[model samples]
Target chain A: MVDDEADLAEAIGKALRREGYAVDVVHTASEALEITVYTPYDLISLDLTLPDGDGRTICRTIRAEHEHQPRILMLTARDDIEERVAGLDDGADDYLVKPFALPELFARVRTLLRRDADVAIGAELEIAGLRLDTAAHRVVWKEAEIDLTAKEFSLLRFFMTNADDVHSQEQLLEHVWDAAADPFTNTVRVTVGTLRRKLTAATGLQWIETVIGAGYRFVKEPVPG
Target chain B: MGRIRLPSFAETIRFRLSLAFAVVVFAVGAAAIAGVFLYENSTLVEPVIMAEKKIVRDLATGELTEVSVIFPEESQRVMAEKVELDAYRRALNSLRTSSFLALGILFLAAFGSGWFLSGWALKPVRSMTAVAQGITGSDLGRRIGMTGPRDEMRDMGDTFDSMLDRLEVAFDDQRRFVAEASHELRNPLAVARTNLELALQGGDDEEIRTAAAIAYDAATRMSGMVDELLDQARESLPVNASETVDLGDLARSVVQDFRASARQRGLRLEVRADPVEVTGDRLALRRAAVNLVSNAIRLAPEHSTVTVSVAKAEDGRAQLAVEDVGPGLTPDQRTRVFDRFWQGEGQEGRGAGLGLAIVKRIAERHGGTAEVVPAGDGSRFVITI
Candidate 1:
């Protein structure tokens, strides 16, 4: 975690370390850049405003220097819209505005860390007779191979990976779709609907359940017909 | 909207002009008539004077008798002299009549032309006034664009245009300062909110939790209400350290800050940015963009996404936009959204309703504007700076 405020930084570091993850706290932008250059850490919690330099520059420089970059989660006291956009553009994978809850911060860190470890963790996923091969970009349901668009494939993988957890259209867009995907577009909804219909047609089971105004949840149990 | 009054006799340039013309023509006509009358009178009297002088000489020499015949035709000379005198009297009367008639004609002609000529000469002034009248408080961007010979009226038009330009800038600066002031105050509140919420989590004991809740409520009250009041009281901040800023970069950074809150609420905050440059106070621009995006996220439904886009508008302006897929604003809502201290229906505790106003102000400072346009099932709030 990188922050200029010592007290806040220490608090965040303690909270993060309590989650059984090794954490290092740094004060200045220079120290942040130095540590990331030497150590190949799994994740970095970066502050936007620092003592020596700004956070966005540090994020960009680190991204350029490190070939296999750590998952960068920007921590900024500035919670305005454009600042957040700049942090993401500066190459941070995720961001948390200051005054954020420790649990919420941890959830984001965990999410980013899981993504970092995603490719290495497994090549195949099996849930409720539906199998997904992460490396091959393939899915099989009830002994039948299913055709999927790249986005649909990723959407299915995300749903399967975070089974029983609800996913919003926005979360799906961020995770499954490309960076250029417009958030205002209904593509996420349309793709999810198509993917669900296709999966149900293949196996006669609805794996993804709509939670209405909340979001979509991946059902662990069989469809309650 | 005040009515354009017909120029009263006292105020109209037309009247003043025509009066001046009429007075000059009348004076010159009176002088000419008097001079001609005097010359004619002198000529007529000169002949009479010569005859009278002859009679006086004859009387003195005893050659003239009142009732004596002086020749073969007794009354011939006397009758001839009487006829000559009568002819002079008729000529003098005719001259007097013609002199008055000439004066009347000239005066009428002078007044007619004076009315039309003044209108023609002041044509530029009238048009310049029309342009000025059209400028309302709602729209200050219009310029006279006056084109004409370089004269007094043109100079006036140019001066008015320059005045409007300065006024627009001054209004813009005032707006930017107001926006920045609110954000400056709110920053600490936002930070306090997070720290309080964090403190609340650490205490699982009921008493401690109660204490934390009180503190959280106090912060919320302070931030959501009191802070706004204080900000309004302070009104404006110093001129933001103006600099050349990358608008796209600034927008992206604000989105990064909202990412966590968006995630926690099951909403996704995403950004589409291009490297667009502009000269402005970076801090103020960021605050404006932040307000817009914050409004979007607050209004957007769960499972929906709030998208921020930064690019160059068609007019070569740096643009930042935040789109929400929530309930689109009503016509009334859209109109009133920028009004200071106005809250929407059911917007009791969210904010002090200064967000959009600040956005508008910031945009103005950058020589641009902020607007909300209806889209799909929501609204797109755009700031072109």
Candidate 2:
């Protein structure tokens, strides 16, 4: 768990522990990232607002380094519709707004944990001539390897995994960066743009399509032989 | 003079009724005074004049000498010009005094009657207002009873009660919708999550990857559903009265945010400036504009330009328009566009279908409106605020 509110973090950690899961609590996204480097976690409950940095950035960093990426559940007080959508789009497994009932919180954690059980822990994904190996953190398109920054790779992986769906910029921010990051910032756009350019240059194909006002859509339509 | 505060609902009812009562009492009092004056002039004073004339003739003809006059000289006259004049003056003086006293009594009676009558007439209304004020969102079912006749006040109360009934029903439906939608979304999300967890528990890499993908999809869909519910819930809230916002600047910022996406899609996104200003909730207005421009970009084909323009309309109304080069909506689609949850054929199941509806509601709340107009090979969504 990552949150600036010590009491809240402690309470959440206790609840998770009671649910039979080992819980590690941190007050800032930076600390959360530092801890995750040495100690692997199965699930991460993140608060978007933190004293040091945003949880979304930490989520991206973890997704980049870890072999089996832990599930993420974003906790935020801001209930704006766009913010929630942005959190989901960025790569968070789920999200809950503040003043949430504890039962609901526990339910969400259970749901995430149960879902993690169904997935093959370290499997690679391939679609539309693009390949992603989760264990290796490597991506290949049209038999050519693509090099991506930690943030870019996580973003591309999220896109390719959820192909043909529209994502809003707000969604991108939440799922791709620390929850504490400024939502109004256009970091997602700049990063996505850079990632798209790099992918196109490496694969020689236009895979990511802008859905206009909506967000972005990863079009996995195969090029004709 | 002391400052007078406007009366509360109860007080206002009492005051109005009292005023009406005072008018009626004044009219009746005036009629009574006129009747009294007429009787004194004709029946009493006129007959006395005739008798006095007969007595005066008898005294002149000497039929009786040294008559003992019970009345004073003025009163004994039989058309005695000087005496009649003096008698007339005395009678007029008495009449004037009596009339003045009667008027004073009538005014006092009228005021007392008005005060009591007003209180009596307004008792039910006061109670009804109190009952109405006690109602809250949770207890919208409570209503004032229509205990009186089918008069205007009763009609007004009945109308008010029925309005509350309608609101209660609407609120009930909304709450149910939110609950049902959330439940529906949760089930699928749970199933997907469970599957992903099982796959993760296994050591198979390919199965884990497939499970992860499915989980992500389910989660995304659930998020979308929740967002829709939230929008629906907020739609019914009263508009917030906040600081002024520059519509032009807001439009520009939203357009700029989407410019990169537009470029990536091989489309142009431009913001035209006219510096239209409006007073409203800046966040809401920005969201409205973002939804409009985003919708435009989605429909516009690659290489087509999407223009966002802000200016004052011909009617001195502030206007913000988002135009795009895409398949224009049919007349039917255009008509249904602003309707809640009404999506065009191709766009069905794509978005929450609440974007345009939200925009329309926001515009209406700001004493403005939104409409779709024909544009260059596409359509323009114009809002006046």
Candidate 3:
């Protein structure tokens, strides 16, 4: 979340964090750009006006520089049609006017993320016999429903979306954790460990496997037996 | 589709001017020609005497002597002069007919030239009308910009352009004021809304408390902004300015009201009053005094005195002023001190910035003036009626 209004930015950041999304808040365009240089966000909530620079220019810079362009959701106090159209024309995926309800903002963020990950809205992610309903944040192993914390659910969602790929701890931190997380910490490993235990305990099979020298990957399917 | 109708010719200035021209020209020409014809006719009717040389027999002389005789015979002289009179009468009748004929032709020629000349002369007015009609509140930049030798019509066009210049500036200021007001309103509104949403989302007690506090602050800010907006609107309204308001009483009341607030800020409220009366709206005058005192209290340093004074000026006008010993305004700030939404340096988020502007409006509505009085130690504001 990027906004010159510090209070609004913090509130939105807290709400997004509660929704199981790792959210970082910044009050200026300079800080927003500085953070984006290191972290590859899937979607960005951008306020149209910032202290250091205009949000549209920041949006354009992000679009031009970032190899993996984050989906930008513009938040502006101006509700004029021309501003909205210009925002979208400048590469904003969506926009919300100021004084918008939290639920509406959350919905837009979720939609943008889903679109970014190429996941169907409200669709359940299934790999082998493990099924995850992203919208409800529910996990099901065969017929038994599994409960997960917000962080664990987010990690599982990321894994299920990229079912057969290896992601390093640093890579996981960049995508799954906000910028506030320590780079040299073991949080990502611990989270992956806990997530693995939960999946194994429920299905009697190890879903996440760590290669000898590579990062962990989620298996697309378990052995037939 | 509606039927097209042409403009009425008689109603146009061109047609009216042309008709007047034709009438004047025809009248003058006919009068001069008729005078000349009348004089010629009067001279032509008189009989001319003739002398004839003829052989006549002298009664007293037997021999016939040749003699010139004057024709005194009335019948023969009438016969001889009758042909000349007839010719002169024929020439006078032709002169009368042809003089009138020339006058009639001159009237037609004058009317045609007058119509064209009037139309040519009104071209600038037509352009000015077109330019005026094209202007609206949203689009104010169009100018007549008449380029010609300075004349009445050109002068009018230049005056119109200058008026539009002033109007455009005023309109731009109004638009900027509205935009700033909305922006100000939106900030607090967004803060309150987001915080309330967070608080209602069933967070922990500490988080909820924080959100509630932030939301409360936002609500207060928004209410303050709304109050200032309301005050501005009310001050701008036309009110009866015939009431005899005592300036001293108004200042004393304002000082009394702000006494506690001023003390809380560690500022002293001093009122020096002499009975002075001004004709204006009592409520508006009181509001202006209150605004000045409150601003002084807000800006003055701790332990400083804020003097509220009301008295009759040397010029016999009533004056009410508030002076504070704090940071004095710069030269630039002093000039724009009463402009809408103008805040002091380093006081970005102080108030809505409409208090001084409202005071100025009230002063003007009462046929008075509000001004910033320069001081060595601090700043002062005065309203004179």
Candidate 4:
């Protein structure tokens, strides 16, 4: 559990610990990033507005560094649809607004954990000509090995899971960052462009399509070899 | 004897009522004068004629010489002349006195009748004026009661009452909307604050980063909800200006945007158009179309299809239809599908339940209507403009 409020962080940590999950509480975004390098957490709860940097950037950094990312649930008081969409787009598994019932928070946390467990167990997911081997963390295009960074791999994995779907930048951030980040940040685009370049260089095919005024899409449209 | 105000109570009533009263009085007074004039003329002329007859009778009988002849004292001839003169004078005096009295009485009666009748007739108008004065912005609900027989006043009161009813309902809805909006907004603000407070307290880099991530997500969702609500509110208002909008293009664009979200859920979103056009506000119409498409995306099941088609109906009205291969609504659900906060059973997680209601309001604003009908094993929403 991480929050600027000591009381809230402590309270949330105790609640999680009571539920049989080991919990660690952090205060600032910068400190939270530092701790992730040493501790392997099962789940993370994030708030968007922070004293240091925004939570979205932290989500991006986490996705970039972590091998097995923890399940993330965003807690916020913002009830706007765009914010919710942006949170989901950022890479957060789920979101709960502030003043929310504790039972609801617990339920969402459980749901994310269950989903993370399922994702951990699933070995491979295939879409069109693209294949992702979760166990190996590798991508193959028509049996050709494609080298990718951790962020690229995660982005590709998210796209494959939701193939032919247009995701807004905010949505990409939410999914990539565990929905605990700012969607307004352009980090998703830079990362996507980089990932697209790598994928294109390796496979000589532009698999990821940009849907203008929307986000990005992974359609099965074949590029000329 | 006090200084009277110009157009005092009596004068105002007299001005309004005196015309008809004066006409009646004049006709009656003229007839009375004519009758009295005729009666006095006959009475005075008859006595004079009787005296003339007595004199003529004496003269014809040669009872006395023409001049200086001894005439009998108190004779019928001598007496007839003297009485004739007195009778003429008395008749003139009596006629003048009675005519003056009659005129005076008629004038007084006319003024009194005019004042009383005008006051009686204007009572309803005065009450109406009072009610009108009370119907300000803060007191729009008050209505004037007719309080009389079924006539023009009743019609006026009924009309006023109906107008007040509509205004009251409109004001009440506005208040409820504002309250709901404020309540919804409070949630996100609280979350953002909590996140900021936690970030400042100092934690491990990972924990801090995670907290930051969660906070960002919350802020984004809150902003989106607020934007959507504001957009809906704006579109629901009646457009003050109108322009020709290409319904086909608008429908296609909205669908194109949602295509990806639909595909992600394994749902196919298709748009078909026939170059339909309508006169309306472009932004408002687009919002309405987007709302419908969004709703379809939410309601359609995974691995199903949502189709949006725009065309002209047989009646030359522009029509747009969004069809989804999802569980359709029941009869009861369809009845209030467009009512605010009307959520169907099993639709708790779908949305805020304001989509259809906003769409309906927009449609009405544009002189159009939205209806949900069963279509192809699911539901189809048709908007005609």
CA-lDDT, candidates in order: 0.73, 0.71, 0.84, 0.72
lDDT value, residue B234 of candidate 4? 75
Task: Locate the minimum summed-lDDT window of 10 residues in model 1 chain B.
Answer: B46-55
Candidate 1: Cα lDDT at A219: 80
What is candidate 3's CA lDDT for residue B313? 86
lDDT of 3: 0.84
Among these predicted structures, which one has the highest lDDT? 3
Model 3 Cα lDDT, one tens digit per residue, B1-385: 8967657978788898999999999999988887898787778766755567777677887567677666569657777688888988898888788887899899999999999999999999999999999999999999999997999998999999999999999898777767768866787788888988888888888988888888888888788888998888777578856788888887888888888998898898999999998788888888888889888888888898989888888999888888888788888889988988666755534677889999999988877899997776898898888
Top-DockQ structure, candidate number:
3
Instruction: Please write out the lDDT profile of model 1 over residues B171-266, one tens digit for every residue.
Output: 776665455544434434444554455456564576355545545654675566565555444335554677899988888889889888788879
The 10-residue segment of model 4 chain B with minimum total lDDT is B47-56
User: What is the Å distance of residue B365 in model 4 from its true position?
Assistant: 5.2
Residue A124 error, candidate 4, Å: 62
Docking class of 2: incorrect
**Candidate 2 overall Cα lDDT vs. reference?**
0.71
User: Which candidate achieves the best TM-score against the true structure?
Assistant: 3
Tens digits of per-residue lDDT, candidate 2, B258-368, equal 988788879988889788778887877887898898788777888988889999988888999998877888887789899765555444224556779889988888889
